[model samples]
Structure formats: structure tokens, C-alpha cells
Target: MKIMVGLGNPGKQYEHTRHNVGFDVIEELSRRFNIPLDQSKLKGLYGIGFYKGEKVLLLKPLTYMNLSGESIRAVMDYYDIGLEDLLVIYDDLDLPVGKIRLRQKGSAGGHNGIKSTVAHLGTQAFNRIRIGIDRPQNGMSVPDYVLGKFHKEEQLQIQDVVQKSADACEACLERPFIQVMNDFNQ
Candidate 1:
């Protein structure tokens, strides 16, 4: 089984913020694959789906961003899956918006969610799909930009990027992490 965990805060208020792109990707996959992530347990709302004949666990952690690892560790242990079988998705501010970087293993790059996950998992090695949320121009603060919603034009661009990220995730289930990193990282 493959575990795909998306990191973000839960609840209505954080719904459309740039930080919630991870949740958005999971939602997109849920809607597209008929996964019906109606169950809530292990500190998350998730479901199982078959992608390329592989059983994949689609997770949106409800423990919020900083404590996301608790949810991830719980699910992974329950399924007896190794860290290598895990795929994480989250927003990134370092890259330009509308781009994604697939990494087989790497540091968190100051992402609290990823940092927490790595700490709990006890390793820096894990597959990740980073959806670029873009750094603010003109010296705008990082927190303000991440917590904010996208502009009208950005909304369309981000939606398209999210869909493409989902496709890349699907491809990961059918291919090796090295292959995915080489093909999807940019």
C-alpha cells in the first residue's frame, strides 16, 4: 500500500489559504477518484483508492500543520508501511507559483509541517510533492502571504497546477521514486 499524506490546517477558516493547497490536492484526488474521504480517524479524514492497481491511502491530516507527523505516524504504523512507501504533498514558498518539485528525499526547507513529519518519522528521507505557493514580492511577510487567499488570476493558475500535481502523484504509484523525481521535479 502507498500512503499519500497532504499537510494543512483543518476547518472552514483555512479553507482557501495558500497553505491549504495540500488539502486541496487531496480533495481534488478524492473527487476525481470517487474516494469518498468521509471517515475521520487517526487525526485525519481519509480514504483508500486504487491507483494503477495499487492501494493508496489518501490522507489530509487534521492535526494542523505543525503536528502533522502524529497523524502520519499513526496511519503508517497501522498499515505496516515503511517510510519509503510514503508520499507527502504540501505547499512551498521557495519556488515560483504553479510549479511542483518531486523529491525522493530531502530536508524540509523550513516547512513546519515537513519538519514535524521528519522528526516523528525519525528520518529526513521521504518522497514529497511540493506545490509552489510563491514567495511574496516587495518584501511582504511570509506568514501573511501564505495565510492569504490567491488573487483572481492566481486562482485559475493554482487549480491547474493542483490537478497536474495529482496526476504526478498517480504516476508515482506506478513508478519508482527516482523516476518520479527525475520526471516531475523542476
Candidate 2:
């Protein structure tokens, strides 16, 4: 089974914020794959279904961004999933808005959610899809910027990237992650 995890905080207040882009991608995947996130367990909202003849579990951790690993670890342990079967989607401050990057493994790059994930998982080797949110402008604090909603113009870009990210996830189900990265990381 393959598990796709999107990192973000829970609650309506965090919805659609830059920091919650990961959740947005997961929602897109859920819709595209016809997977309903109807289960609340292992500290997350998840749906299990088959995609391209492969078992897929779509998860959005309810433990919030910083403690995402707690939920992910529980689910991994319960399902006996290995690092190779995991794909994590999250936002990146370094890339421009609407851009997406895929990496097979790397450091968290100062992302708290990923830091927590690495802490619990005890490794940095895992697939990751990073949707770029860009860094803060106008001297805004990182936290404030990440928690803020996207501008109207940026929303269009975000929509496109969400679709692209979901597409990448679907492709990963059928092909090797490295191939998907090569195709989508452009």
C-alpha cells in the first residue's frame, strides 16, 4: 500500500492559507481519485482506496503541521508501511508560487512539519512534493506570512499547482517516484 500524507494544521482558520497548501493538494487528490476522507484515525483524516490498481491511502494529519509525524508514524505502524511507500506533500518558502518540486530524500530545510516528521521517522529518506509558496515580502514574519491567505492573483497559480501536485501523486502510483520527479520537477 502507498500512503500519501499532506502536512497542514487543522481547523477552518488555517484553511487556504499558504501553510495549508499541502492540505489543498491532498483534497485535490481525493477528488480526482474519488477517495472520500471519511475516516478520522491515527491523528488524521484519511481515505483508503485503489488507484491504478494500487492500494492508496490519502492522509491529512489532524495533529497540525508541527506534530505531523505523530499521526504519520501511527498510521505507518498500523499499516506496516515502509518509507518507500510514503509520499509527503508540503509547502516551500524558497520556490516561487505555483511551482512544484519533487525530491526522493533530503533534509527538512527548516520546515517544522518536516522536522517533526524526520524526528519521528528517524530518517530523511522519503518522497516529497514541495509546492512553492515563496518567501515573505514586505518584512513580514515567516509565521505571519505562511499563515496568511494568498492574494487573488496568486490564487490562480495555487489552483494550478494543486492540480499539478495531484497529478504527480497519481503518476507516482503507476511509475517509479524518480520518473515522476523527473517529469514533474520541471
Candidate 3:
């Protein structure tokens, strides 16, 4: 079994915000595969789908961003999934918009959710799919920026990124995480 966890805050206000890109990717995958993430268990909203003959669990942590680790830990523990069987999707402010970084292991690089997750899992070596949201200008608070919606011009590009991230997720499920990372993280 494989678990793909997308981290984001849940609610109307979080829609289309930079912080919610991971959620958007999961939503895209759900739509593409026609699998509704209406089931609630393991402390999250998730759906079980088959990808290439393997059962894939798609999870959107509903505990919001700060305490997102709870959902991840709960799902993994309940299913007895190893850390290697997990792939976390999240937004990254350090990278430019439209870029992606899929890493096998790394530090959170200042992401609070990832930081909390590292604390819970006792490792920085889990697989991660980092979707770039771009950094805000000088004097702009990161939290505020990430919590805000994108401009009209940025919307289409963001949508494209979301869809591509979904494809990357599928690719990871088909093969190894490194193959997807090497292909997408260029």
C-alpha cells in the first residue's frame, strides 16, 4: 500500500491560496481518476484508488497546515505503512512559481507543516513533492502571502502546475520515487 498525503488548510478561505496547492493537486488527481475523496478515516479526507494494479491511498490532511502531521502519522500508523511508502505534497516559497522539486529526503527548509511532520516521524528523510509558490517581495509576511490567492495572471500557470503535479504523483506510483523526481525536478 502507498499513501500520498497532500498538506493544506481546509475551508473556503484557503481555496486557491498558495498554501493550498498541494490540496489542489490531490483534487485534480481525484477528478482525473473519478475517485471522490469523500471518505473520512485515519484523521483525514481520503480515497483509495488503484494505480497500475497497486492500491494507492490519496489523503488530504484536514487538521489544517500547522498540525498537518497528525493526519499523516495517523494514516501511516493505521495502515502500518512504512515511511518509504509515503509521498508528501506541499508548497514551497523558496522556489519560483511553476517549478517543482521531488526529493527522496531533505529538511523542511522552514515549512512549519513539514517541520512538525519531521518531529512526529523522527526523520527528515521521507519523500516529498514540493510545488513552488514563489517568494513574496520584501516586507511581505510569508504566512500572509501563502494564505492569499494568486493574481489573475498567475491562475492559469498555477492550474497547469497542479495538473502536472498530479501526473507526477501517478508516475511515482507506477515506478520508483526517484524516477519521478528525476523526471519532474529538473
Candidate 4:
């Protein structure tokens, strides 16, 4: 089975914020594949279903961003999932808005969610999809900017990227992750 996790804070207040883009992508995937996130367990909301003949579990960690790894570890242990079968989706401050990057393994790069994930998982080797939110502009504080909602003009781009991210996840179910990265990271 393949596990796809999207990291973000839970609650309506954080919805649609830049930091919650990962959740947005997961929601898109849920909509596309008809996988309802109806189960609340292992510190997350998740659902299991078949996608392209592969068993897939889509998860949104409900422990918020910083403690995301706790939930992930619980689920992983319960399902006996390995690092190679995991795909994490989260926001990236370094990339421009609407852009997505895929990496098989790397450092956390100062992302608290990823840092926590690496700490709990005891390794940095895992599949990841990073959706770019860009760096804060106009001297805004990083936290405020990440927790802020996108400008109206950027909504279209956000929609496009969310759909694209979901598409990449679907592709990964059928093809090697590296191939999906090569095709989507452009």
C-alpha cells in the first residue's frame, strides 16, 4: 500500500492559508478519486481506496504542522508502511507560488513539519512533493505570511497548482516517482 500525507494545520481558521496548501492538494486528490477522508484515527483524517489498481491511503495530519510527524509515525506503524511507500506533500517557501517540486530524499531545509517528520522517521529518505508558496515580501514576518491567505489574484494559480499536484500524485500510483518528478517538476 502507498501512503500519501499532506501536512498542514487543522481548523477552519487555517484553511486556504499558504501553509495549508498541502491540505488543499489532498482535498483535490480526494475529490478526484472519491476517497472520502471519513476516518479520524492515528492523529489524522484519512481514507483508504484503490487508485489505478493500487491500494492508497490519503492522510491529512490533524496534529498541526509542527507535530505532523507524530501523526505520520502512528499511521505508518499501524499500517506497516515503509519509507519507500510514503509520499509527503507540503509547502515550500523558496519556490514561487503555484510551482511544485518533487524530491526522493533531502534535508528538511528548515521546514518545521519536515524537520519533525525526519526526527520521528529517523531518516530523510522519502518521497516528497513541495508546493511553492514563495518567500515573504514587504518585510512581513514569516509566520504571519505563511498563515495568511493568498491574494485574490493568486487564487487562479493556487487552483491550478492544487490540481496539478493531485495529478502528480495520481501519476505516482501508476509510474515510478522519479518519472512523475521529471514530468511534473518542470
Candidate 5:
């Protein structure tokens, strides 16, 4: 089975913030596949379904961004999911807005959610999908920048990017990670 976890804070206040793009991607996938993320367990809301003949568990962690690993770890333990079968989606400040990157394994690069995930998982070797939120400029703190909502123009672009990210994720279930990377990492 494949487990896809999206990292974000849980609440209306954090909704639509740049940091919540992970949640946005998961929601988009939920809509695209009719996954119905209505089951609550392991500090997350998840839905299990078949995508392209592969069993998939779609999760939106409710532990918020900073402690997202707790939710992921719990579900992994219960489901016996290994690192290779796990893919985490989250926002990246290193890339420009509306861009997306697929990495087989890497450091968190200052993402608290990824940091916590690495800590709990005891390794940095796992699949990750990073949706760029762009870095803050003009003296804006990183936290403020990530937690802030997107501008109107950015919102439009991000909507399209989120849909693309969702498409990339679905493709992941049907092909090799490297192939998916080659297809979407442009």
C-alpha cells in the first residue's frame, strides 16, 4: 500500500496560507479520486481507496505543521508502511511560487514539519513532493511569510499548481518515483 501524507496546520485560520499548500494538494487529490478523507485516526483524517489499481491511503495530518511526524508515524506503525511506500507533500520556500519538486530523499532544509518527520522516522530517506511557496522578501520573517496567505495573483497560480501537484501524486502510484520525478520535476 502507498501512503501519502500532506503536512499542514489544522484549522480555518491556517487555511489557504502558503504553508498549507500540502493540505491543498491532498484536498485536490481527494476531489480528483473521490477518496473522501473522512476517517479520523492517528492524529489525521485519512481515506483508503484504489488509485490506478494500487491501494492508497491519503492523509492530512491534524497534528499541525510543526509536529506532523507524530501523525505520520502512528499511521505507519498501524499500517506497516515502509519508507519507500511513503510520500510526503509540503510547501518549500526555496523554490519560486507555483513550482513543484519531487525528491527521492533529502534534508528538510529548514522545514520544521520535515524535520519532525525525519526525527520520528529516524531517517531522511523517503519520497517528498515540495510545492514552492517562495521565500519572503523585504525583511519579512520566514514564519510570517510562510504563514501568510498568498496574494491574489499568486492564489490563481497556486490553484493551477496544486492541481498539477495532485496529478503528479497520482502518477506516482502508477510509475517509478524516478519516472514521476522526470515527468514532473521540470
Candidate 6:
């Protein structure tokens, strides 16, 4: 089985923020695959379904962003999923908006959610799909920037990225992580 986790704070206020892009991707995936996120457990909302004939568990961490690892660890333990079967999706300020980068394993690169995940998982070896939200403007704090909503133009682009990210997740279910990275990391 494979588990794809989308990290973000849980609340209506954060629904449209840049930091919630991960959640957006998960919602897109759910919509595309007909997976219903109807269960709340492990401090998250999750649904199990088939994607490309493989069992896929779609998870949205409800423990918020920084403590995402807690919910992820719980899900991993409960399902007995290994590192290789786990894929995390989140927003990245380092990449340009509407772009995505996939990595088989790497450091968190200063993402708090990734930091918590690495700490709980005890390794940096896991699949990740990073949706770029672009860096904050000069003089804007990182927190404020991440928590801010996108402009109308940016939102249009983000909608495209969300769909592409969902396609990437589907590719991961059918192909190896490395191949998925090579195919989607453009």
C-alpha cells in the first residue's frame, strides 16, 4: 500500500493560504480518484482507495503544519507502511509559483512540517512533492507570506499546479519514485 500525505494547518481561515497548497493538491487528488476523505484519525482526515490498481491512502494532516509528523507517524504505524511507500506533499517558497519538484529523499530545506516529519520518521529518506509558492516579497516575514492568500493571477496558476500535482501523485502510484521524479520534476 502507498500513503500520500498532504501537510497544512486545518481551518477555514487557512484554506486559501499559500501554506495550504498541499491540502489543495490532496483535494484535487481526492476529486480525481473519487476517494472520499471521510475518516478522521491520527489527527488527520484520510481515505483508502485504489489508484492505478494500487492501494493508495490519501491523508491530510489535521494536527496543523508544524506537528504534521505526529499524525503521519500514527498513520504509518497503524498501516505498517514503510518509508518507501510514503509520499508527502507540501508548499515550497523556494520554487516559483505553479511549479512542482519531486524528490525521492532529501533534507527538509527548512520546512517546519518536513522537519517534524524527519524527526518523527528518523530519516530523510521518503518521497516528497513540493509545490512552489514563490518566496515572499522584500521586507515581508516568512510566516506572514506563507499564511497570506494568493493574488487572483497566482490563484489561477495555483489551480493548474494543484491538478498537476495530483497527476504526479497518480504517476507515483503506477511508477517508481525515481521515474515519477524525473517525469514531474520539470
Which of 1 and 2 is ahead in lDDT?
Answer: 2
Off by over 4 Å in 2: none
Model 6 / residue 149 / CA error / Å: 0.8
Candidate 2 lDDT tens digits, 49-165 = 988889999999999899999999999999999999999999999999989999999999999999999999999999999999999998999999999999999989999999999
- lDDT of the structure predicted as candidate 6: 0.92
Candidate 1: lDDT of 134?
87
Error of 1 at 70 (Å): 0.8
In model 3, residue pairs whose N, Cα or C atoms come closer than 3 Å (at least 3 residues apart or on different chains), thus clashing, are none
What lDDT is reached at residue 169 by model 6? 92
Ranked by TM-score from best down, the candidates are: 2, 4, 5, 6, 3, 1
- Candidates 3 and 5 compared: the better one by TM-score is 5
Q: Clashes in model 5: which pairs? A: none
Q: Which candidate comes out best when scored by lDDT?
A: 2
lDDT of 3 by residue, 38-86 (tens): 8897678999887668888889998889888998998889889999899
The whole-model lDDT of each prediction reads 0.89, 0.95, 0.88, 0.94, 0.93, 0.92
> What shift in Å separates residue 145 of candidate 4 from its native position after superposition?
0.4
Alpha-carbon lDDT of model 1: 0.89
Q: Please report, as a residue range, the 10-residue window in candidate 1 with the lowest summed lDDT.
A: 177-186
Candidate 5 lDDT score at position 174: 87
Report the Cα RMSD per candidate: 1.2, 0.6, 1.1, 0.7, 0.8, 0.9
TM, every model: 0.95, 0.99, 0.96, 0.98, 0.98, 0.97
lDDT at 129, model 2 = 95
Q: Mind giving the per-residue lDDT tens digits that candidate 1 earns over 1-186?
A: 888888999999899799999999999888877788987999989999786688888999999899999999998988788888998999999978899998877898999999999999999888899998889888889888888898888998899999989988888877788887888764
Which of the two, 1 or 5, has more TM-score?
A: 5
